[model samples]
Target: MPMHPIEVDDDVYALLQQHARPFVDQENDVLRRLLGLDGSPTAVANRVSGGDLRALIDAKLLAPGDELVHIQTRKGLTHRAVVTADGNIRLPDGSTYAKPSPALKACVGHDINGWGQWIHAQSRESLQSLREALRERQAD
Candidate 1:
């Protein structure tokens, strides 16, 4: 699971406290149930209902996982992701990130696909071979 660090303000904190009060069993539950979790390390998923969950998610105070990802829209968002064996990115938003063009600079607009643009090979032969291989494979 990926962890997105977020800052909470006093106002939001107070609101969460109020909403989570009845569900909370104690301090432990206050952190858990208020966050609408099963008390496991998996973290609160985006699939949860209610305004409070949305509030927390938009604030970045919480992150939704694989099972809960569809509950949210990640249209223009980008996250630090890793590449798999097939050259696909395991995106933080739980989406597959394809490679980007060379002009893909980190601009304020347009989410950059870092995996797509990052240099892949150091050796000249490897680079040429992979490039040709990918082109041929895609053409077929």
Candidate 2:
């Protein structure tokens, strides 16, 4: 494949950096992942191999397509995201985030603890609590 160069602003570059896997993802890899161009079997396998939410799914704590909700009383806002088959969080607009924090941050416009804030819509349980339960199970 031939490589081409394109220019992006600082913010765009930073966004790519945030989504990148440290030391493992080059710029093209990050771009491919973010752009949903990594749909090949190998790419899907690599993507699903590991992630925070993937662990939860493996433990049966969260199922794929489960909705996670965040309520910001101060801003009078409610945001929703769904867990993808590979454990990524997918917002309604079709953007997928690899981690909870960045997923919530995209909606809230600031840094927040997504594990504590994003509630499982059906169970009304915070992800943090679920994580704790998974931890306890593992420790046994």
Candidate 3:
């Protein structure tokens, strides 16, 4: 891949810095679409519309997954599991979550890096069912 020098304005540069992951994600999506990997919004649109090659050149940005972890906090007093979307764990009680470091492991016998590693849950509803319910209500 050849690198091109395209100068962006200050605002765009700030946006790029602020939303770096999304920009990178959009690029990855474009490449994946070209390779026929499905599931992106643009890829779905391209498949349906036929003449729109926008998905080929387009970039779709989205938020990253949660930063999940199991944490032990405050003088070996309490332990509860939680997942963070942005690595933030500051509670109203003035405590913050930390990844299980060696010191934490020393305090507690067992150590775990993440809660989402062992903690999993799922949503029960689908788009079709939800849409059908909405349509029925609207008809009524």
Give the candidate number with the greatest TM-score: 2
CA lDDT, every prediction?
Answer: 0.35, 0.82, 0.33
Question: Which of the predicted structures, 2 or 3, would earn the higher lDDT when compared with the native?
Answer: 2
Q: Which residue segments of model 2 deviate by more than 4 Å? A: 1-35, 38-50
> Which candidate has the top score in lDDT?
2
- Model 1 TM: 0.21
How does model 2 fare in lDDT?
Answer: 0.82
Writing each residue's lDDT as its tens digit, candidate 3 over 15-129 gives 4444334534453333343333436453354344532112211211111231212334455454332222322222222222323232224334567333222221122222223
Q: Worst 10-residue stretch by lDDT in candidate 1?
A: 64-73
- Output the lDDT of residue 86, model 2: 81
Report the C-alpha lDDT of model 1 over 15-124, residue by residue, as the tens digit.
55564545434344555443435443323222233322233234332234311111113566332333332333233322232232211222223554332333332221
Writing each residue's lDDT as its tens digit, candidate 2 over 58-104 gives 88889998999999899899999998778778776545777789889
Q: What TM-score goes with each of the models?
A: 0.21, 0.68, 0.25
**Residue 82 displacement (Å), model 2:** 0.1
Candidate 2: count the clashes.
Answer: 0
